[model samples]
Target: MRLVLRVGGLLIAICLVVACADATGVPGASGADVIFSDGFVPGQMGNWVIEGDNAGQTAVINEQLVFELADNNIMQFSTLPDVTFDNFILEVDAQLLEGDLGSSYGVLFRMQDSTRFYRFEITGDGLFMVERRDGESGWTRFVDRWTETPAIQQGLGSTNQLRVEALGTNISLYVNDELVHQFNDATYSSGTIALDAGTFVQPQAKVAFDNVVVRRP
Candidate 1:
C-alpha cells in the first residue's frame, strides 16, 4: 500500500509494508503492472550492459544478482533494458552479503549514457546520497555529503527494499518501506536504468539484488 505524504506542497510517496517479501512481486505494491523484472534465476546477464570500474563484477549467484568487487571507491553497474519513464516507480531488493556497513549500493536512473545519470544510493550504515555523473569528469553529489537516516537498516547481511520514484519532476527515495528523502529537479527526462554497487572505506563490498520491478506511479 502506498501513502502519499504531502510536505511543503511536494508529494512524497512511500509504500508502507511490514514484510517486504510478502504477497506481490511488485515491490510492496498490490496489483501493479510489472513492466520489467530479473530474478537472475537463469544465471545469466543476457543483454544488460556492464559499466563502471567494476563493470563485469556482477554475476548470478544462488539465484540472485550479486556484485562482489575489489577495493574501495569502485562502483559496479549493470544497465538493464529499455526502462525509461517520466513517471514511474522502480524497486529492487538488495542485501549486504559481505562488507562494512559504510558501503553503499542502489539504483541509477534517468541516464543519458554510461557516464551521465542520476543515482540514488543507500549505505549499510544508515546513510543515503544522491549524485549526478558527468562523464570522465566524475560525479557531483547533490547532497554534498552522506546524510544519515534511520530509515535504512544498518549492519552487514541486512536486506533493504530500495525504491526510487520519478513522478514528473518530483523524486522520492525510500528504503525498507520508509521514505528517507525527497526532492524536485527536472534534468534528463528519458534514459535507461541500472543496478549499482560500490565500496567506500571497506576493502571490498558484496551485495545481492533480485526482483526488480518497474511500474507506473
Candidate 2:
C-alpha cells in the first residue's frame, strides 16, 4: 500500500510540473522570448496609445483588445521610439472578434510616418494583403488578394499567426505555419513596427499578441 501511494504521488508531481511548463512556455513560433505582454488591466497604459478614427469605439473586453460592433471599426497605435530593426523576425497571434464578418486587421512595418509604411493585413474574410502607404502615393495595393483563407470567411475567435522578417529589402510572411506572402520593397529600409486595426462597420474585432520576439541579425 505504501508503494502505491508513493507511485501515485510521483505521478501527481510530474503532472503538476508539466502543467506549469505548458502554461509558462512561449505561446507562439519557437525560439522567441516575450518582451512586452499586456493583460489590459486598467491604468496599465504605457508604451501604447489608442488612436485612429475608431479609437473611442474600441475597448478592452475580458482583457483583450476589442473593437465594438459599430460602423467604421477603426483602431490605431502611436507609441514613440519606433521599433526599428535592420534584420529581425516578429510574430503575433490575433483573433478577430465574432460579428466581424467583413473586417480586417494586421501588422504594420517600416512605419516611418502616417503616410509612409507597409501594412500586412488579414481580412475578416480570411484574405491577406500587403499595402504600401507612401508619401507620394496613397494606400497603394502592393498585393491585395487571398493567400491564406478565402474572403468573407469567419476568422474571429480563430487564432492566426502573422510573421514578418526584414533582411535588406526582403520581406516574408507566414500564417498559421504556412508561408503565404513575400515581397521585396526598397521604399523604406528601417522604421518602426506596429499593429494596425482596420476600418469596418459593426464588425467586432479583438487581437491578442503573444510571443513577440525580436532577433537581431
Candidate 1 matches the true fold with a TM-score of 0.78
Candidate achieving the largest TM-score: 1
- TM-score for each prediction? 0.78, 0.68
lDDT of 2 by residue, 1-217 (tens): 0001111012100000000011122334244443333434445423344432323244445545454433343444322233455666766667776555555667777878555677777776777777777755456666644345532235567777777777899988777767777788898888776655544545345544443445564
Most accurate candidate by lDDT: 1
Local distance difference test scores for all models? 0.68, 0.53
The lDDT of model 2 is 0.53
> Which window of 10 residues has the lowest lDDT sum in candidate 2?
12-21
Model 2 lDDT at residue 144? 46
| lDDT of candidate 1 at residue 134, scale 0 to 100 | 66
